[model samples]
Target: MLYIQEMHEGMKVAGIYLCKSRTAAVTKNGKNYDNVILMDKTGTIDAKIWEPDSAGIEEFDALEYVDVVGDVTKYNGNLQMSLKRARKAREGEYDPKEYLPTSDKNTEDMYKALLTFVDKVENPYLHKLLEKYFREDAAFAYRFKTASAAKTVHHSFIGGLLQHTLYVTNLCYYFTKYYPILNRDLLLTAAICHDIGKTVEISAFPENDYTDDGQLLGHIMIGAEMIHDTAKEIPGFPKKLESDLKHCILAHHGEYEFGSPKKPALAEALALNLADNADARLEFITELFKANMQKPDSEWFGFNRLLESNFRKTGDLNAL
Candidate 1:
């Protein structure tokens, strides 16, 4: 099968792909078309059935595996497809694993590394809370490891939540060594549990879409609530400690405009917020390079909306 990332202009496309989305549209001349987004593990691409009402176009919708025959074309510097034929793939006709994106790192290894940090937490209440979710709660542990950090953006693949958590935790660990003022246990605990609410915010793979709770409350609020509820169950948990920890999660985004419910109030909260931003931006840029790496001759990849600037590779050091 041809992955979306491997596709180029003027290539003929024929194979099964996951239909991530499908919508009807009308052209200026009133011609009907079906705007579709096709997906595979590598990534997704835009597709269109220009003649939706014409014969040979099969019935299918979002979330179904589709068999398509089309010509790859370029529109406004992006690759798109002009489909001639399409149909809903029969059950067992295609492999489901090929359609979902997955992380390159092993999930188990990442989880174990996270537990090492948990072992380091000296605060009894915080340590117990970490164990309640990561070590003792079998179902939550499985979901946390498997869930994506977001529906899109950085770390949007399987094992993404765990991967992001580990990266953030590593950064937090370094902060504890360099900055003696920041509470090590609080910072590390906040980092590990930062995006745990994503397990409920975004559904598991195949769909990987937002749930009702995700749409209504979002991961930030959901996560804070989860932390509060869990802490209440632990005996002798301090009230001030719980508030401080929740503040870190709520303000991790760092600003109100960025979806943070509050700005960082404590030194530890500030450090966690900065670390989260750095890791997220780094991952986002890495994904940008990977997606556009197909163009070997081009130096400039054009402007990135996420980064708010144009980007170019520095090329190999050996060549220099």
Candidate 2:
């Protein structure tokens, strides 16, 4: 199979890929075309059907599998497909798993690492709260382990949520070590629970897009509500601790412009906000580099809206 990542300009590709989305549009010249997004485990690529009425073109819709024959082309520094033909694949033609992108890391290993942080929470109330969702709830544990952190940004593959949670937790753990002024227990708890709502925010793989709840409530608000409702079940859970934890979740985005319902107020909340932002931005840049790995090491990658800059690979150390 030709993975999307392995595709390059001028290559001819023929394989079955999931149709992530499709749309009909009219060119400025009044010609009609179909814009499509195709996906395989490696990543997604934009595709265009310039002659939609061509006899060989088969009918298909978004979320269906289709066999495509196309020429790769570069547009605006990104690889895209200029389609020659496409047809819906038959039942025995493809495996669904091949079309979903997944984390290279083992999901179980990521979950275990997250638990180590959970075990370190010394505060009794915080510890119990963590235990309720992560330890005691089996269904939630499975969902959390399998969920993606987002539909597109940073970690968007299967097991991505757990991988991202562990990274943020590790970062928060180190922050507490280097700066003892921060509350280790509070910050770590916030880190693990920060994106927990993502389990519901985005649907599972193959349909890893926003849920109705995700659109209406978002992960931040949903996560805060999850923590609050769970804490209410614990006997004699401290009201102030619950409030502080929710505050951490609500304010973790750091600013109103960034979707943070409340800006970081507590010292621990501030630490978590910084850790979360740094991890997300760094991971995004790393993925951008990987997608363009075939380009010359010194070649400029392209302008990145997220980082607000163009990027290029540093020279190889061996050359030095």
The model with the greatest lDDT is: 1
TM-score, model 1 to reference: 0.94
Q: Per-residue lDDT of 1-320 in model 2, one digit per residue for the tens?
A: 88998898999999999999999999999999999999998899999999999987999999999999999999987899999999999998998889888888999988998999999999988999999999899999999988888899789998888988999999999999999889889999999999998998899878799999999999999999999998999899999999999999999999999999999999999999998998898878778877766665557887888788998777542332
Give the Cα error of residue 293 in candidate 2, in Å: 1.5
**Alpha-carbon lDDT of model 2:** 0.91
Off by over 4 Å in 1: 26-31, 91-93, 315-320
Model 1: pairs clashing at backbone N, Cα or C within 3 Å: none
User: TM-scores of all models?
Assistant: 0.94, 0.92
Off by over 4 Å in 2: 26-32, 297-299, 315-320
lDDT of each: 0.91, 0.91
Q: What is residue 63's positional error in candidate 2, in angstroms?
A: 2.4
Each prediction's Cα RMSD?
Answer: 2.4, 2.6
Model 1 over residues 114-163: C-alpha lDDT tens digits? Answer: 99999999999999999999989999999998898888889999998999
Best candidate according to TM-score = 1
> How many Å off is the CA of 205 in candidate 1?
1.4
Clashes of each: 0, 0
